[model samples]
Target: MTADPLRIGILNLMHDKVDTQLRFTKVLSEGPYNVDVQYFYPQTHYTSRPVPDLVQKISQPLDLKQVATMDAFIITGAPIEQLTFEEITYLDEIHQLIDVLVANNIPQLYVCWGAMAAANYLYDIPKFQLPEKIFGVFHNYLRAQDPLLKGLPDGFLAPHARYAELDIDKIMEDSRLVINAVTKNNFLFSFRAREKNQYFLFSHLEYGKDALLKEYLRERNANPGVEYIKPQNYFRDPLHMKDPEFSWETTQRVFFDNWLHSVADHIATQQFVKE
Candidate 1:
């Protein structure tokens, strides 16, 4: 008999719910575990607005009372990088969710802005704002060995589009957090807290090939005066903006697959101990 599908809770802070859902499904599909996703949104930020039909299925209010118990969890990036963690619309609610994840020892993947928030709220790690957005597919090197990045090449490209930096020194010194990957510029690429069963990625590995281009165009159109450099090592031609390499697709798939497998192993181990 087939094993029951893993229930994955996604604390989706992104505004574009449909696009985010698509990227998540595309990546999770690569792993062997079948997933039942229940979307959670902060009520203050999203309110009672009706979600599209596609989102309606998986979406639910981020109610602390419901307290979703999941096999794994994923927190999507938000555009609230400029604001302080406490300044976010639903302050206590988000923290409550994070607290639950920690208290329950749930395995979690925090991406981009979500990673920054996790670092801040969990460990009191501060973020530094960059002069300009670090928008591109950057070359990242392996900092240490970990299951999530095991099969990846020595160095590979990961997409980033953020305007702030996490305190690298603090994370490095923390005995609990393992720095698995870092960029040449000292940007924290990925880190996992084994004891807490949490993973953090500052880059958006689930981004589609055209995702960066769309971001560039949106920024340029919105603020004509603002200088928006095209994402580095991304476009086929800077002028034409054709042909993205999609170099990170496989890495993205395998990363999530590793997490799923790890969660499965942890559950099995617990079951064995009980039996």
Candidate 2:
């Protein structure tokens, strides 16, 4: 008999193009599991308001039933005020999703803003505000060995875009989760759900090179006079932005490949069983 395809539900919290979901699907599908993606937009006031074209294009309500049918679910980040979960218009919907996922013991992966959402929902911790926006490729160091980081180098670079940080102390306070990695800025890089099959990443492991430039341009346009006008000095000169080699597409692929491999065992166990 042929093996069943792994049904993967992608909860895209952002109001950007579906490209983020597509990139994630591309990487996860490369492994032993067959992947399927479904997007969910939280029905909240903030999302409903008029916003950028990118946000409008990707906004839609995601059915919860999709969560029940998947072997794994990946939740993308969103742009919102992170001071408190209440401030996020989709706060209730996110909480509802978390409750359902936890009840079903479903495996999940949260990236960037998704990570903050997971952290807030899981720990009741408030998100920290940044003095400035965090953009470009940032380096992360594995604090300990974990399945997600297996076969990967000690340090890896991934794209990031946010102005809020999570409280590591509060995250560590929860005995159910494990901190897998940390950045130099003392931010959580990666974390795992304690009892349930869930993993969260605060970095954009699925972003390609072009995506980074696109995001940079978007931010540059959105906030022209922000204090941090210049890109991070660690990356190559932005003057060579046209070059494809400087893109982080390869890094994104590697990160996704490792994540897929890490979840292979779980995928096998949850493979579709015909009635």
Most accurate candidate by TM-score: 1
TM-score per candidate, chains pooled: 0.92, 0.83
Question: For model 2, how does the per-residue alpha-carbon lDDT over 128-232 read when each residue is reduced to its tens digit?
Answer: 888777766667788777776765666676666777888788778888878988777866678887777778888777766566666666767888876444345
Per-structure clash totals for the candidates: 0, 1
Worst 10 residues of 2 by lDDT: 227-236
Give lDDT per model, in order: 0.80, 0.68
How good is model 1 by TM-score? Answer: 0.92
Clashing pairs in 2: 15-55
lDDT of 1 by residue, 67-182 (tens): 54677788999877877776776767777888887777678789999999888888778888888788888888998998988788877778998888889889888888889998
Root-mean-square deviation of Cα positions for candidate 1 versus the true structure, in angstroms: 2.2
Clashing pairs in 1: none
Task: Give the runs in model 2 whose Cα sits over 4 Å from its true position.
Answer: 45-60, 81-83, 225-228, 233-235, 239-251, 270-275
